[model samples]
Target: MKKTLYSLFVFFFFIAGLTNVRSQDISLPAPEKTGGKPLMQALNERQTTRSFTKDDLTLQQISDLLWAGWGVNRPDLKKRTAPSARDFQEISVYVALPGGLYLYDAFANTLKQIHNRNIGALSGTQAFVATAPVNLIYVADLGKLGKKEGDEIKDAELFWSYANTGFIAQNVYLYCASANLGCVIRGLVPKDKLAPEMGLKSNQVIILSQTIGVPQK
Candidate 1:
């Protein structure tokens, strides 16, 4: 009986250790909603960069970036920084960092811990993706559009979702430009390999991914 108890204790600790390694909710600093380059200059500087350094982003920067991408500006109606068709606001932003994959809750302005693995490498097909500090995977949660469980997701139904994600991605691009960071919006994600890693449901369709980091000088 003592031996059995010892085995159980060890197993419990092992599970706990693994759990600690796999999940962490980062409560980001409040975003600075003001003070950047003029809108025209940000537009002019918006561009893609495929090279990056592995330097992690600061908490403030992460907060601001996520806010720019899709944070809710109007809480009364729950409207986001980016608009959606019929205001469904169905796009879900999954952030893959060195710690793990997180879901950005724009209204709450928090990064909820999802999977604990460093799945940032799976965000894009390009080699540079593995080294980038941040990978934002935009997923269309069709369930938000009244999709029942196990409802089929047709490609035709995703047109509006694609448009919604584009607005969010462009916001990220402009934010990167204004902040003097580097980013690239990409569609070359290995969705098959990534869905499992991200712990996504069948109703969650991967739309696009955008990688960001300190530009390699």
Candidate 2:
């Protein structure tokens, strides 16, 4: 009877572990695009300007920006503005706003509030993070890239994560160009502090932050 009880406990434990793994899968929201000036015009006008006007973006504009940055674009669900290694969309954007911090839910096409107010202090000492109308914090989940046979291969996957993040950042830059907004991507930040603040896992990495607002006149 003792052996049978032990066996049953182990079997249930294994099943529970699988259930927990399945619950963590994320489904991003559909991408929304608005008609605007051509891509070339936006690219030509694209400029990284750190100085920004103290103006907040409307919900529609915010939606468009996120869509352009990394939101899903196709009905087939295959392509995005940014390229992901092995089609593993490991990058997540955390929006830091005056009201609070929000995680962009791409699949749901909505912003889920992560905090009630500004928590830019956790990002860095820079005043820009706090003052900008919106700050996009890009994070990459290394584990999402999948397991490899060796440490070197794992490191390579991490590099791919960073590369893919740049793709998303550039997409945002171009989107800002079309919208005539000011933006800048910065890499200087305390990563260790940000990960926990953002509620990320141990294998996740904070790639960079982009501050966006109206251009200071």
Candidate 3:
């Protein structure tokens, strides 16, 4: 009798978990592409910020931020805002929000929920990462580069991926500057620990992490 009751309990727990994940999936509003501080000005103003406030950003801000980083600029060509070497476009942007972790679906203008668990602290080693409103994890899908999942990924193979991530990260930097937000691109990520939490496959390599939030005043 105890065995049967335990099995039923486990079954209900699994179903509830799936329901929570489905509920956490978010459909973002269309990004605001026009009107901001001009290009040169945003560039000049761009700087790394370590201090951040716990205030949450609006859904609109999140939408625009992801779009600026990697949205499809040319729908006809399916091209992105940031350039990719040989157009491999291997980088996938995963957002770590207070509510959960999500992958930025640039084409759909939506954030597909990865899990309904907050992994903000795992996004970086910095103390501020634990409280930042957003953390963007730049992951490289090596499958697009002809490497099979579970295959060993070499540093040489990731040469172009690093450069590609830089472009995307910089795009976010500029967007933060124009929006008067604070952000810092970080290399001090605990990849070994974070990878498992993010459920990353062998082929999906984390390249960098960027934290974004309102500057603490």
User: Which candidate has the highest lDDT of all?
Assistant: 3
Q: Across residues 72-111, which tens digit of lDDT does each residue of candidate 2 receive? A: 6863875676788788888888988777778887767678
Preferred candidate (lDDT higher): 1 or 2: 1
TM-score of each: 0.88, 0.77, 0.89
> Which residue segments of model 2 deviate by more than 4 Å?
1-32, 147-157
Overall lDDT per candidate, in order of appearance: 0.90, 0.78, 0.93
Clashes of 3: 0
lDDT of 1 by residue, 101-147 (tens): 89998877789999678898887889999989899999999999988
- lDDT of candidate 1 at residue 166, scale 0 to 100: 97
Error of 3 at 49 (Å): 0.5
Q: Report how far off residue 195 is in candidate 2 (Å).
A: 2.0
Ranking of candidates on lDDT, top first:
3, 1, 2
**Per-residue alpha-carbon lDDT of candidate 3 for residues 149-216, written as tens digits (9 for 90 to 100):** 77987789888999999999999999999999989999999998999999999999999999999998
Q: List the residue pairs that clash in candidate 3.
A: none
